[model samples]
Target: MSDFTDASTEPDANVSGATPAPEATPEAGTALDIVVLAGGISHERDVSLRSGRKVVDALAEAGHNVTLRDPDATLLPYLAEHRPDVLFPALHGSSGEDGSLLDLLAGLDVPHVGSAGAAARRAWSKPVASSLVRDAGIAVPASIVLSHESFRELGAPSVLRVVQRALVGDLVVKPASGGSAQGVTIVASPDDLPRAMVDAFTYADVAVVEQRIFGTEVAVTVVDSGDGPQALPPVEIVPTDGVYSFQARYNAGETTFFAPARLDAEVSSAVAEAAVLAHRTLGLSDLSRVDFIIDSEGRPWFLEANVVPGLTETSLVPLAIEASDRSVPEVYDALVRNAARRG
Candidate 1:
């Protein structure tokens, strides 16, 4: 494992401190009424609230009138009444990423900053997203998607045997349609596979058991601010406990993040290209985060893609934003303006 402190000192021109020229879009100074939806009934409600507050603060700082609203029964009616210029969804997990809210927003003729409903559905399912990305020429791990019903119908032992034989290595078991590593588990021993499956099923009915790729884990955020999707500096994740669980992701100091990940120039470029490709393949817009593992040979293997990725203080996208010599407020401001123009 690379020492986090040492990696921070290494110089990489791709993520240098110098700011690049901003892409031309709607004027940044234009203030718009923005509703930021944060809290939902999903398991990630707390994280969503935190993300929402951060977004509200940043957009407000950028001179936009921002309202932090929860996606309760009153959300749609409130939007219909107020008709905010644009909506910034900071929701995570099923409540936001599952595409229902985006579809409703579309029905209301409200422009929001993120992927469309259809696209969000494609990206929300880890299996679906992986297949699409793989067809687009990206390397995704081999895995079997098992639903709880299947696990029950077929004997657990029989299914486990097939999975263990097919994957034949350390496996990463996670809920098929959620984020924040809520119920993700790393099973090195076959004895742990059954428990991992149970844990995964606790979060979602479907579970994905895939071959665990051992390498440096990194997250590349793609942002399309009217200039097409572009990749930000990749942020390397090094968790002290060897697993980026729910705690490691949300709690500060649990993981060491090296923004502009400690990859060679060639590898970094490839990672960025892969991230942009994943974003385009999944039909994601505005913002998304593509996670990967760079193996010993520097090949970037897709882990998953997040549509409404976390925007909390400890999130990867914000780290990448700062690493690219940009501020969170400005980038989000540009996204809001772009959505408003589309409307």
Candidate 2:
């Protein structure tokens, strides 16, 4: 891990070199730290804040103490001072989900909800995550990773030649790291490839070119308790004008969300099972949201996973629960109970 995270890291409270809190069991009904990490130094800082606020509201409604922090890396210090029973990182995009914070937390032995840092790092990067998860036997879109240096060294014409030879049909270009569809482009012709790569490079040094999977895309929200994890109903996304871009995501009524997404019983069950398998395969814990693209052949292809999916009122996960006849409070309450046991 990098020594100092992205230049905004808060100094350790234990600079005096005090030991971290003992890894002992947490008491029942203990008032928790419930830290909601928001406003990271990523492009999706605003989105993270929105998600964090929703999480704070939900956890507070469930009767827990909540502390909402912004784009600073003082989480470790906070854990050292006031040992919250558990941390709920509502951070999104790169700085939050790239696994740096998770590693720091694990180093402090602070038990937080969500996947581990390593897992988050892999899952946050589309190319790396897709490669690893696909090798683990999940169905994913065929893709290739291009390093900025490699592309620059090879020259645009040579890289384009390579791309022409390797990729077939329409291609989706994206930053290998982060989410919220921050830097992604769909190129339909050879002429658009250069712009796509440039757009993708705006987000990360590495870019991924993926085969466009055909069919409706759906995101499955799952929660893992002490017993085991369970998958909530899937939310199907239908973006207007053929782009499920940023505005479509945050803008109300821009896209139609189909909860319990119009599908056969068997199809829905299969999707849920795929989501569970993905969580396990990716080494995720506590909670995750698996995205999938159901192809023309009626097969579901994995499309990366979200360690900290959104929790806003317009978020898909909450909508899925409501569709399943469950309330947000009940779900989050179980997570708290589970954390208490682990604490």
Candidate 3:
């Protein structure tokens, strides 16, 4: 068990014209037994471990009995015997976000903090999620989803020709179902497209080649303690190297973040509204982070939605929480109590 310590930091003030969510009612000062699962065999295993540690520390500071555990073969048997009051999964990548583990937890009648299995499935696949959000009136970038097998059978030359014709601009290629920018590449030149596809395929069987939307990149975190889900302040991402790669995300000084973003009042409100709409449209619960790109015209384009967003020291969610004038412990505490009540 990791020692519990206060991890709250003073972030920049909330974005102008952004209304913070109302403080959730506490759970009568009752400390409950909580198990935080982390460290899966996914490519994001290290990130998941870091996020899990952060969660464990915050929950412990909130007066809960927290235990940190890895998701291994013995996990299910351990849960069956111990049955903590609530399970808080800080896992990332496919192990946690792909809905397989969530479904198993549901089968065991475990009350975990996150979206349900069905909702997680909808948000895991980039193509499916983009389509669903687009149907709900959100603007998603035009892209093509290709399977590795299809890319080989159809011949790379033919596929690249069609892709270039369809998306006539700088393109961004990434794995169809993963996060933390593990296998993402920006293709400005046509010669880079084939290599980008191979990089994306290294992470997942399917790859998404999308039109690179040039603008400010921001991430909005939505939290549902007990009341309906509400959007937190948006966190603008500015990487020193120009690309928010895996290093920029977890490294301490590789990127600079502007909490609540630097957009105007009207645009800020619109971004928050769009985030909430995307959350509702995807049927997500507990907590989620929706990413977007704000064009020069002030239009918010949906990039992706994360059901289990990172909570590490340098993660955007923590930055948004502090920017909203709320502590990480407070937010995590409410989620645990809410999950227990639902159970």
Q: How close is every model to the real structure, measured as TM-score?
A: 0.92, 0.88, 0.92
Q: How does candidate 1 fare on TM-score?
A: 0.92
lDDT of 2 by residue, 243-340 (tens): 78887777776778888787788888888998988888778888899999988766889987999887765677788878778778667767866876
- The residue-by-residue lDDT of candidate 1 on 1-343, one tens digit each, is 2222211121221210112223334555657888888878899988887788778778877778777777887788888998989999988998999999999999999999999999999999999999999999999999999999999999999999999889988999999999999889999999999999999999999999999999999999999999999999999999989898898887777899998799999999999999999999999999999999999999999999999999887788889999999999989989999999999
In terms of lDDT, the best-performing candidate is: 3
lDDT for model 2, please.
Answer: 0.77
Q: Weakest 10 consecutive residues, lDDT, candidate 2? A: 1-10
Choose 2 or 3, whichever is better by TM-score.
3
How high is the CA lDDT of each candidate model?
0.89, 0.77, 0.89
Stretches of candidate 3 off by over 4 Å are 1-28
Query: What ranges in model 2 sit over 4 Å off?
Result: 1-33, 71-74
- Clashing residue pairs in candidate 2, if any? 26-343
Candidate 1 local accuracy as lDDT?
Answer: 0.89
